[model samples]
Target: MRVVIALDSFKGSIGAAAACAALAQGWLAERPADEVLLRPMADGGEGTLDAVAAALPEARRMPVTVTGPAGRPVEASWLLLPDGTGVVELASTSGIELLAGELRPWDASTRGFGEAIAAALDGGARRLVLGIGSSASTDGGVGVLSALGLRFFGADGAPIPDGGRGLPEIVRTDAGSLRLPPSGGVTVLTDVRNPLLGPTGAAAVYGPQKGVRDVARAEAGLARVAEEAPQIDPSTPGAGAAGGTGFALLAWGARLVPGADEVAALVGLDASIAEASLVITGEGSFDPQSSAGKVPGFVREAAERAGIPAAIVAGRITGDADVSGFAAALSLSELAGSPAASLADPTRWLRAAGARLAAYRTQDE
Candidate 1:
């Protein structure tokens, strides 16, 4: 049987590619001569660089010194595509994963994200594709602006401290000293469809995930920023991603596109799925969010068009999941010998799950 193992990273446990490898290993053990293809996927959030790099060998990793989510010094990497296009993932610098439990969104900043972009520009990149998601801040990208030489002055004309809490104090924005590569273009890749402000805005929908407890206060602060800032559409798809980093990039002339679509096209995933008899795709969890431009849903749709059976294997599955488009949906937790205990050792569970899946191929009647 020709099987394609396309899966997303298991968040805190293993990367997408590693999961695929584990699955492939089990399948190979069951069917030694079976043709298996492994393709790792991401939602334009974390692990995006690794996914694209795996597909495009010509892409080079460029390291840059930038601030972490908490303003600490760190080294982050961005991809330099062969065609002078740079692929930078904001999660590398401003991701929530980098922050300890004590830090909050009110104090985090996207300044490091901007620094990475500048570094990419300095490296002779003419176009930049910024994957924005899993951000630790809700600063409306003001921190990024500050890094790019745009001064965010308070009512007293003094520069405010970095973060979303400081957004309410901004009285003016100076962009005269901002520097940009002579011939560079910027595009923002995101998975969210929330707006920059209002109930479904970045702060309202994502602030709590970044450690904010007072949603009302955070929403009010963000609303003020929206009122004071220059005109920028926040309602556009993906604009609210990365804590409004998409809106900020849009303000700076970055084209926003669906994260999965961009990555799929770049990796030629459609063609690969077309050639497979069975396409298996999944993520850490399955929910309504998976339907919102995520990889598994996209792969399922593509597989359906090609008359290929698509199956999903997730760590856990919830909600009224629409499996009509897929051949089957399997939750690793359900098949795990010890579901509760397996959460701590996902690698074992994933391998066990893979073996269980392979067993299905052995049953004749």
Candidate 2:
């Protein structure tokens, strides 16, 4: 049997590439003679850079230091595509994972993300594609703008305090300080459709996730920023991703595109699906968001177009899931004793799940 192992990261447990590797190892144990293909996938969020790098052997890793989510120094990684394009995932330096519970949205910033972009520019990259998701802040890119030389002033013309809560105090913005590399073109990949302000805006939809309790306050602050800045079409898909990072990128003249399609095209995922007998794809969780141009949904569609059966193995499955295009949808917990136990021991569960999946093949065939 020919099997293609394509999976996303299990979030805090394992990376997409490592999950695929574990699955492959388990499958090999059960079906030593079968042909197996490994593919790591992402939804244009945290692991996008690694996913693209895995598929494209020509990509090179570039190391850089940037400010962390809390304004501390942190080392981050980005990929340099062969075409002189830099691939960066904002989460590497500004993701919620970097913060402890005590550090809430009001204290987070995207300054590190800006520094990463600056580093990419200094590294001779003329084109930059930033994957915006899983951000730790709701500053609507104020910190990033600040890092890029944009200055925000209060009513008295003094510099405003840092953080999303301070956005409402901005009286003026000086974009003259904003500088880019000589010829760098910027693109942003996102996975949400929230707008820049109002009910469906970034603050309203994602602020809570980042620890904003006073929704109205945060929304008002973002609205003020929007008034001073150019209007962004929040209706655009992925506009709401990364706590309005998409909107920020738009303000910075960065092209916003759907994450899945961009990553799929970059990794030649469609072609791989077409050539595979069975395609396996998954992520940490499968929900309505998965249908919003995420990796698994995209892979399932591609597999359908290729007349191939696609299976899914996820960390958790919730809310009456509907994986219509997939042949089978199994959670790692289903093979393990319990969901909580599987989450606690993902590697063991993943290996067992792989073995069970491989056992489905018929020897007579």
Candidate 3:
């Protein structure tokens, strides 16, 4: 039987590729005669670039140094696929985790992400794939736009400051020096669908996580940006992603696509699953959000569509998550007897989960 194993990163623990390898190791130990395929996955968040690099053997990593979320220099890298498609991830450039638990809601910036994109363009990337999840700023993407030569000016024609605090002073935009998108254009990947402003939007919904104690101020700033650029629709789905980075990219002529679906297609997941006897998918946590544009949920749905039994292995299966769709489900946390123990050595637990699942499959067969 052919078994396909695809899993997202276990967050702060093991990455998707490592987790998949560990699981495959255990599965093969029990079912040595079975064919196993590994396909690491992500939803355009923290581990996006790693996932893509793992899936595409010919992809190259280009190093870059740019402004971090907290206005510090950060060393990061973007991916260049064999097809001349450059992949830039915001999480590695201007993500919140880079701040080391010191959130910067008001002054964080996405300038680093833009710098990485510019580097990719300079390196002759024919197309761009940007993963904008896990952003650390609410600057309405001004920092990124600025890096790409889209100037934001105040009433005196002086350049506005960087970050969310600068948004309220924007009076006009000048794209005079902006670099045009390549022939293949740009695709922005994100799982979020919230608009740029309002109760369900960027500031109101996500600001708190970034340490924005005054949501009203952030909202006003984003609103001002929208007003100045009426040509760009603030109400567009995903416009609020990465603290309005989606809005800026849209203004720069990029289209927003669902992160998981796009990554799946890039990895040819459907084709892989069609020939598989069983499919196993996983993530760090199996929660309500897992079913909403996340990798494991997408993999499971694909398996269901192909009339194949799908199993799931997660770091922890949350109480409210719906797992009825999966043919078999296992939690590393449960297998290890505690969340702490499971996380202490995720690969070990992942392997055990894989072995148990393989045993269960054998009994069913």
Each prediction's RMSD to truth? 2.1, 1.9, 1.1
Q: Which is better, 1 or 3, measured by TM-score?
A: 3
Q: Please provide TM-scores, in order, for all candidate models, with all chains considered together.
A: 0.93, 0.94, 0.98
Error of 3 at 185 (Å): 1.1
Best by lDDT: 3
Per-residue error for 306 in candidate 2, Å, reads 1.3
lDDT by candidate, in order shown: 0.79, 0.79, 0.92
Candidate 1 local lDDT, 170-218, one digit each (tens): 7787889877643667767787788877778887788887877877776
Query: Model 1, residue 166: what's the lDDT?
Result: 72
- Candidate 1, poorest ten consecutive residues by summed lDDT: 221-230
The 10 consecutive residues of candidate 3 with the worst lDDT sum are 224-233
Can you tell me which runs of candidate 2 are displaced by over 4 Å? 181-184
The sequence of per-residue lDDT tens digits that candidate 3 reaches over residues 239-343 is 999999999899889999989888887787899899999999999999999998888888999999999999999999999999999989999999999999999
> What digit string (tens of lDDT, one per residue) describes model 2 on residues 262-317?
88788877777776778888888888778667778878888888899888889887
Query: Alpha carbon lDDT of residue 22, candidate 2?
Result: 86
Which regions of candidate 1 deviate over 4 angstroms? 181-184, 227-229, 362-365
